[model samples]
Target: MQVLTIISGVVGIATSGTEVWHGIYTLPLPVMIVALLWTGARTREFFAER
Candidate 1:
């Protein structure tokens, strides 16, 4: 789950950045936001387990 979240976040950021570079910036924003939130939650959980 943790690894998946991290990968998802990375992919989301990359996709968003690519889209923005092409001057298309509306669609990927929500995806990037969700990915960031998910990654943060997962990372927090992971650290709390240690």
Candidate 2:
């Protein structure tokens, strides 16, 4: 959930650069990738905890 939120936020900022600095484009892709992997890790951990 957090990962999706972050991705959406980054995408929003990237698409609408007026909100965040235009230079933010350099970071979102990497951050989004890590967020995706983190989400997967947390999801697996959740299942493992059960």
Candidate 2 local distance difference test against the native: 0.66
lDDT per residue as tens, model 2, 1-50: 54565666678776885766643544566677776776886768877955
The TM-score of predicted model 2 comes to 0.35
Q: Look at candidate 1 and give me any clashing residue pairs.
A: none
TM-scores for every predicted model: 0.33, 0.35
Runs off by more than 4 Å, candidate 2:
1-23, 41-50
How good is model 1 by TM-score? 0.33
List, residue by residue over 1-50, the lDDT tens digit for candidate 1: 54555455566667776544333333356557666876876778977855
**Model 1 local distance difference test score:** 0.58
RMSD of 2: 5.5
